[model samples]
Target chain A: MSTVLQSLSTELADAVESAGRAVVAIHARRRIPASGVHWQPGVVVATNHTINRDENITLTLPDGTTAPASLAGRDPSTDLAVLKLAGQSLPVASLRRDAPPKIGELVIALGRPGPGLTASWGVVSRADGPWRTWQGAEIDSLLRLDLAIYDGFSGGPLIDAAGRVLGINTSALARGVPVTIPIATVERIVTELLERGNIRRAYLGIGTQPVRVPESLARKLELKSDLALLIVSLESGGPADRDGLLLGDVLLELDGTAVNDASDVLAKLGGDRVGKPLAARLIRGGQVKALQLTPGERPTSRAA
Target chain B: MTASMTAGLAQEVAAAVDQLRQITVQVRTHRAATGAGILWNGGEPEGPGLVITNAHVVEGERATVELSDGTAARARLVARDLRRDLAALEFEPGRAVVGAVVRDSPPLRVGELVIALGHPGGLTGAATLGIIHRAESDREGRTPRWIRADVRLAPGFSGGPLADATGRLVGVNTMMQGGLALAIPAVAVEAWVRRSQTMAVS
Candidate 1:
């Protein structure tokens, strides 16, 4: 038992030592952080390729070694990609668990900002499933970190004391605090990427608008909740349209679950709904109607 | 025409410029200032006047006219096509006004003499002389005729008439090339003015 403990201690120390030295700084040109609010401390996260990959890209490694890295793959819809690097024994950061972290827990970040390895320490500011970034993009799993995040800290790793990656440092707070992607979400994304090349999302191809029913209108309509989803536009030949969903219809529920917000419908439509028949309830002209819809394959907008 | 014929041609050109003074209106826009000349009346020279200008001169404004002699008149923007960057304006009932004689065709050839007339930089009457450098059949596939010249037309000279050596209106001075000169063919601009008039009448 004493021998095993000694061996484990030595291995852990070696792993830390190797990882600290192996984490290299990456820099690509014309790939700038979107806004200040999403800035993360100590590390700069950057897109390895330009928003449009046709432009030239420059990647710099730690120790001032710069080279060109080919654009691995990017999903236009998701705006995520894997940039291929040529080096060996790259220090891979471990992902955090999918569960939300307890509030007030300490979080740290390690990033290759500019020319050196930078570290930022903060606490888990907020753990919300959905919060919008400064650019009007809704971050699905947002873990706000309490740190003054500057530019060049994007695409860096937000980690914990155990060296587990809590999330990918994405942006800064509107008031200049840093924000990150929750580890649980990143882990699921990694799993999905390993099994499938991209984030496999299910779509119904229907535009929805939030209906904030007035108190009098809700009483007059005799609704359970004041919230309703007004179907705005239905894509031609989409599953929703084929299932008899029409414009001006107000959606009530999906698969026996009431939907009070647009995110609720989206959350239910995540990977599980792929090729699955769903029960959608709608109120058209104050008459409730249910339709059976089997989701179709999401439109592929990529070369591969 | 020969210089002997043009001996009176300059006087006639000055007279034409004098007649155009009634229709030569000052247009003030948010970003720039320009002048436009109206060909009052129809082919018979006895109908409501029509304002002619480079389309860029009067963009995005409710039509209103200001005469060079300083009388403001209410006008209506008739038609605008960006391809040619030319626009027309229609006005209410007005008295007899002078109109130019359109050249039967584009300029004869490169080095053919031409005179540009307008208010360069808002100066009342400015004229520059230069020979046509190149006569192209088409510009961006819209107007199939354009003349590139060395005569300089300043910012305020757009929509001013470009007359041949014989003093016949041949083009509507449009843009300057590196402080040089360029004009849209008068026949094409007249066609737009005519088409716009027909639409306004109907």
Candidate 2:
């Protein structure tokens, strides 16, 4: 090869190598109850609930070595898992701090999409309203990616061009939208899962429905015009029932803060409220009553 | 080795890339749902006839692999390290083929020579060359630890081999940016593969 040609060839080769290293793939095979089976993408962060002895998992690197990864800890409340790799010096992901991704920032999702490490780039289309996931948990903040989320990129990192991870690619909106768990939320969940066996969550065993305070009802009971969490069904031994709460009670406030919606109550109760007392104010039969309830440990489902 | 020898070795290895074809993978149930390509190396699926691709290629799948030649088979998926992104595919049936040797040290400084081989764009056997821009860890960026070169990588180039002027397996061609390509340092991959194998056995 001529000197110039050799130099050119060398430069091209180096570029190919560097770009390949940043790409990582996560894979998982999940068995959904009643749904039969489901496939997951990206690196499988095996949780105690999902990865079992009969299940199989493999982790692949940029250079293409595949190894079976074992299950670590899994906290379903947060949907986080810790996977230990016998492998080391594996290229760690770049974490973005200081500033969260702006709502319109362009981000890239890389994983073994459809079989090999592939890159899918998109912009933040919207950072909007909370949505309840399939697990029946509500997320207050979320990022909407423009690209379509394929099945295999779940646990893979959604990174910026500078290579900082913004979040973990989670699910895609069936309506042509992709969703990722924000890095801040993921960090908190992962930290909790690693430190504790499970995510500590406060629970009130009552099914709630958000009802707009009627003008007539508001006038009769001095209620706000905004939405309020209405107690629908109270579990027999729940904290709300033990705190002298009634079935027809309209929740007005929690912990001295006015409640605007059902999600507001969930936010106050779910995280940072485990094993603590919350003062709940409610209106029953046109009478206002204040009750202090000491929330108890959430009941664990037997499924996982 | 001398610079001339290194250059010659690169040519020899580059030439060998022409004979290499196909990477084997076993797509797990979840991986298969993502709609991935199949590596077809001919012959039987079992025995020594397996394909070898990047470990990431077969993530979320349980699999064993075979090389292009019908002579080698390896047990796959013993252990994996997420930090390094390396996995060891092991099989008891086939003889262990001696893979290409890699240099122990990092690549030469900026503007030095480098080369890569892989099925870029599904081109079963191809060789491309480029120059090193710098020697830096991947932590500074999102790309993997590699020799950042000016090589171009099309689709399907991942898990390919990268060599220095001496034909040593210095890195594994993995990704590309514009015209810049990245390769995982061979020493790093080798070290992790060995370590994962130990854990798989014990």
Compare the candidates by TM-score and give the number of the best one.
Answer: 2
Q: Report, for every candidate in turn, its global Cα lDDT versus the true structure.
A: 0.57, 0.54
Off by over 4 Å in 1: A1-22, A31-58, A67-72, A75-80, A94-102, A128-142, A161-164, A172-177, A212-223, A300-304, B1-202
Predicted candidate 2 versus true structure: per-residue lDDT over B1-202, tens digit per residue: 3568668655655554432233322222232221111232223344432233355655743553434453333344545455554444445544433445556754344434566665444343556655454444534433346666555666556666666665556666666764457667766676665565477668
For A12-84, candidate 1 gives per-residue lDDT tens digits of 3333233234344444444442210111122222332223453344444544465444443444332344444
TM-score, per-candidate, Cα-based? 0.46, 0.50
Candidate 2 accuracy as TM-score:
0.50
Q: Which tens-of-lDDT digit does each residue in A1-304 have in candidate 2?
A: 3444345435434432333354444345443210000012222332233333333655555555665554445655444455555543454555676666767675666544322344445578877666655444555457777754433445556666455666666543223345766666666665665566466667887777887777777787776555777888898888878877778788888998877766677667665677789988887776778888777767664334
Total backbone collisions, model 2: 64
How displaced is residue A21 in candidate 1, in Å?
Answer: 3.5
| Least accurate 10 contiguous residues by lDDT in model 1 chain A | A33-42
Question: Distance (Å) between predicted and true CA of B163, model 1?
Answer: 80
Off by over 4 Å in 2: A1-24, A30-56, A113-115, A127-141, A172-176, A212-217, A301-304, B1-202
